[model samples]
Structures are given as C-alpha cells and as structure tokens.
Target: MRPPVEVSVLILSLSAPGVFITMNNIPALQEPLPILGMGMVVLGLVLLLLLLTVRNLKKVDPLFYVFAGFSFTCMVFLTNALEQDGFISGFMAFYLKMGEPHLRTAYAVMTSYWEGVVHLLLFLTIIHRMFRGKSYRSLGLLWAGSSSAIIVHIPGVVIGKYGSNIQPAFWRNVPFFLVPFWAASLLFSRPREMPVVTADKIIAEQKKGLLSRPVDLLLSLLLLGAMAFSVFRGFVVLDCPLDACFTYVYQYEPYLKDPVGFPRVMMLVYLFYALPLLTVFIYGLKTPGCSWMLDWTIFLAGAMAQTQWCHIGASLHSRTPFTYRVPADKWWPVITLNVLLAAVPALLALRCHNNPTYFLKPVPEGQTINEKKKN
Candidate 1:
C-alpha cells in the first residue's frame, strides 16, 4: 500500500492536475459556460460578504486590502476573457483565425485594452506597497522606474496597431522603460532588521514553548529566495530582447504545438507567478500567527483559475494528442511526474504547520530579543 502521505499527494495530484498542468496529452476541457456563470455568482456573493465583514473586522494594513482588490480585478478581467472566448461568437471566431488581418486587428485592440488595465492596476498596487513605509525619494525613484518601463509599451502598442514609423519609436524606447524598474527592485530589497514579534511577546510566547527560530529562518529564506527569483526572472524577461525572442521561438511555439510542452511551460510560469502566494502560505503555515491562510487559499484558487487560460490558448491552436486519450501505458507516468512537482509545495505547506522542525532553528535568544526591540 502507498504511504498515507504519498496517497494523499497522489489524490491531490490527480484531482487538480488541470489547474497546474500546462502541456498534456489530455483533451483540453472547453471553458465550462455553466461553471463560469456560477463562478461569477459566487464572486459576487463573496464580494458582498467581504464588504460586510471588513466593516466589522479590524483595520489591517490598507495595502492588504489594495492587493486583494487588484487580485479581484484580475479575476474580473479573466472572467471577461473567458466569456469573450467561450460565449461570444465573433470573439471566438476572431481568436480561432488569428492570421486574418481584421481578426488580428480586433484581437490586438481588445487584448491591449484588457492587458493595459490589468498591468496598470498591478503596477499601482506594487508602487503603493513600495511607498507605504518609505520616503518620497525612494518612492520617486520607483515611480520614475516603473513609469519609464510602462511608457515603452506606448510605442509598442502603436506599432502593433499602426505601421512602423520613422526613427523606430517603440523599439528604441523599450530599454529605457525596462531597466530602471529592475534596478529599483534590487535597491529596495532589504531584509527586515526588526523582529516580527515584540521582545516581551517573544518572552511570553517562549514560556509556552511555541516559538521555533529555525523554522522561522528557513521559511524566511525560502520566501525571500522565491521572491528574488521571480523578480529577477521578470527583469530578465522584460529587459532582454533576446530573452523575449527565445521565449517566442522556443516556449511560445512549443506551447501552441505540443500538448505536453504546454503544461511544462505553464508549470514553470505558475511557479514564478505563484511565488507571492507561496510565500504567504509558507509564512502562515510556519507561524500560524495571522489569518493569512484564507488569503493564501484564495490566491491558490486564483492561480488555478488562471491555468484555464494557459490551456485555452494552447488547445485552441495546437494539434497535439491528449495524453489521457492515449493508452495508459504511454502517458500516465509523464502525467504522474508533472502532478508530483505541483503537489510537493502544497504538502510542505501543510506539514510545516504541525512540524516546525521542518524549517531551520530559531535565531539566538539575544539576537531575537535585540531584533524585537529594534522593531
């Protein structure tokens, strides 16, 4: 018999493979129209609940609320995309025949409008977070960087819509817009010099033997590494024209052709995109101090919703065979491995809650006390 843990992992793996699977031999599920409708209803109910609950709840950092709002807006855009692609004949027909000039033009217009809104909101949230506790000098630098990078899209958008102009405006402006945002990220990433809990609180909590320093350090390191990797990759992908070309050639094309390759790329992309939620999960599971579990779960749900987008793009275009449609002998193992990779972090998140030793040792007592006092 499989170990209970292994069995649980396997169950999770199969149950939600589509949520993380990018490229697979399985037939891509059509956008469930009923499910989408139901989801919108549920979202509406949740929003109403949030409005009511927050009024009675403590005033936590407004940044958290801002992030939540951005996340919801992203979901709204995603739902709109789904409705357009799934229910609207004109939109679906246009996307299906992407090579058509008129369709391409329409797609360019609609996609640009939606993407611009999403990016603008996301950028605003990030900027708001950066400026929350920092000086205007720091905020100004970030503003200059993010704004400059975003400005490059203006020419790129124009070029996509109109014929190339004199002096090659968009192409020339791209780098100036990208470089500073990356530079600002590196400049801003300072480790918290203060303790998360107060010195008195730590002493009080220590009496209960609840504080585990090693676990805290390990979780912190994991979160920091994940965040740093994501930001670094974002910079590399955004700033390097060569990286974009390679992505278009290798990752993008394979995604549209090979079913298996689609999931692989998607898994990689989600691993990056989900880093923030993963960090929250790690911290919450390790500490169990705050009520971020709900937030983490919601983020995970949002990530799962996004997997549909990845599969929709590939399935609509690709001619690859579905793995599940193939013989059990051929594709099950590949599916199994992909599922395992996706399940590992979730299991780790759960285990960390009960086993603090899963992470590193606590900071030295004197250091912990000093840090807490400084904070």
Candidate 2:
C-alpha cells in the first residue's frame, strides 16, 4: 500500500526544499558544476526515495517514475526563479551559461515561475493520486498540453533570436520535450471519465444543432473571433505591411515586434497550431460524435493558459525593453484580448467536460435496441 497523504507530503516537504537549501549554502556547490552529475544526483535520489517508500511503485505505471523524477527537478525551476529575482545566486549561473543562455530572458523567468510554483503543485497532485491508484488521466492531459506549449515556444525563441548562443546543456530539453508526447499517448489511451448516460440521452443530445445549444453557439462565436485574432497577430509579427497590421503592431501590441522573438514565435504558434484547433473546435461544437473535443479542449486549455501567462507577463515585465512594451493607452485593450485568448479554450473545455452527452458517440439503431432490451 502507498503511504498516507500526510506521509507523502511530509516526505516531499523535507526532501525537496531541504536538499535545495542545504546545497545552496555549500560554497563548493555554488561554483560551476557539471550538468550531468547534478541531474543524475537529483533524479537518482528521488527515484531511490520512491523505491524505498512506495512498495507498489514498480507495479504502478512506469510513467510514474518519469513524472516523479521530473517533479523533483522543479527544484531547478525554483532555483531559476530565485536566482532571477536575486534571492539566490551563482548556483545556476554556470548551468544557464552552458545549457540555455536564453534562461536569462524575461519570458524564461516568467516561465520558470509558472513551472516552479503552479506546475510543481500540479505534478505533486498527479503523483499523490497515482500513488493511491486513482485516475490521473485528466491532469496528465492538461500537463501534456501545458508542457508541450512551453517546450515549443522556449525552443522557438532560442532558435529564432539566440541560435548562436545555443549550448550542449540545451540538449537536456530533448527529454522534457519528448516525455509529454509519450505521457499524452498513455493518458489518451485511458478510458474517458464519461458519465453513464443512456443511449436515448446520447441520441437526444447529439441530435441538437449548434443553434439549439445557446452556450455552444456563443462559444463557437468566441472561438471564431479568437481565430481571427491569432492570425492577425501572426501576420503582425511576420511584418505584414498592411496598414492595419503595421499600425496595430506599433501602436497596440508593440511587444509582438520585440527583438527577443518570444512574442513573435508565440503568435505564430497560435496561428499555425491554435488556429487549426480553434477551427476544429467550432466544428466540434456544431457536429455530433466529435468526442475528441473532450480531451483536446482540456489539452488546448492547458496550452493556452501556459502560453498566455508567459506571453502577457513577459511582454509587460520590467525586464522587457520599455519601447517593446504595450503602450499605456492600449494596455487594457491589449490585455483583455490576450486574456480572452487564454480563457476561451478553458471555457470550451469546461463546456465539453461538464455535459459531455453531446460529444458522446450516438448509439446506432441496432445498439439502442439491444441496450433497450438489456435494460
């Protein structure tokens, strides 16, 4: 049996921060260190603790080891945040220089905060539930999308603006990028947490068109608007010389033109990736049997949440050059637009999850008869 929740919490509390703080105080540790040695020690210790404490750890999903090990590395993320904020120093300077010099960017600092605090807590919750043999598919999918977005834009900025500065330590992100795809496949393979509705109910829900579902109709419109906005910003970043794109890029979201390239790559991600998804979302809303919406919406919601958080925060952060920041006159409008971009997918996900009958597969006439007879 797994340990009680309190025991797990207590163990983590003592292990993660305790080790980090102790190492921070060591003058020798503060010096430049080999990334390989540090990574092995952190992951090895966490894996060792799990082996000793959780008896059934091996019997549980093997992915547990992958996630749990990654979770402890949130300490590195925390270290990044602390070092950036000046609460601690030197520990990560060598690693950042050798691995990802772009870590010094404003967007990366905000990304560190998100990963350290929010994503760390999320991983812990997932680990706790997994320890107890509970379903963590939903959370897994969310993290999959969130992590995928981070991995994409982070690399995009590095290649787009800092290509010359790339280092071997940067290759460490290869696993971080790949793990999400593997975890997502595992999560999607799990049966969905669908309510046990009758065939009749599924048929009735699926029969209704988009207009009949006022909420879905509204959501579809919002998604369309968001799609347009995504493409617009994408063009703005690409230097589309149209009057509106040119004017808006300069006067409104000047951050899109930031030389650092994070915002530019972000908008392109939305355009190329999110735009197609948004189009499919509208189709899912109008059509029946699009059960994929349930998972993808949650996935997109997570992606949008992480993407917009980094984009919005980094754009206005004091670290961003003032000339590239959103103009004061346009701050509210610009923020509102970006906030809506993040929020719409989340709302769509909630809609699909809350009343999934519409997205549930419609029963064939023969199956409905069989089910009726069985009932």
lDDT of each: 0.37, 0.78
- TM-score for each of the candidates: 0.31, 0.89
- C-alpha lDDT (0 to 100) for residue 73 of candidate 2: 66
Over the stretch 88-203, how does candidate 2's per-residue lDDT look in tens digits?
A: 86566656655567777778888888888777788788877876777788888988889887655555757567777776556667778888888899888887766667787788
**RMSD for each model, in Å, please?**
16.4, 3.2
How many clashing residue pairs are found in candidate 2? 0
Please write out the lDDT profile of model 1 over residues 1-375, one tens digit for every residue: 433322222232232223212212212322233333333454465445435534543553333332333234333333334444453222233212221122122222233334335433443445344435432223223233223323323433344323322222123324335544454444345332232433344444444422455545554565565455444434433334566545532433222223233233343454455666666665554553443342234334323332432333333332234421323343354334334433444444444334332232244455553453445
- On lDDT, the candidate that comes out on top is 2
After TM-score superposition, the amount by which residue 194's alpha carbon in candidate 1 deviates from its true location, in angstroms, is 13
| Residue 243 in candidate 2, Cα distance off native in Å | 1.2
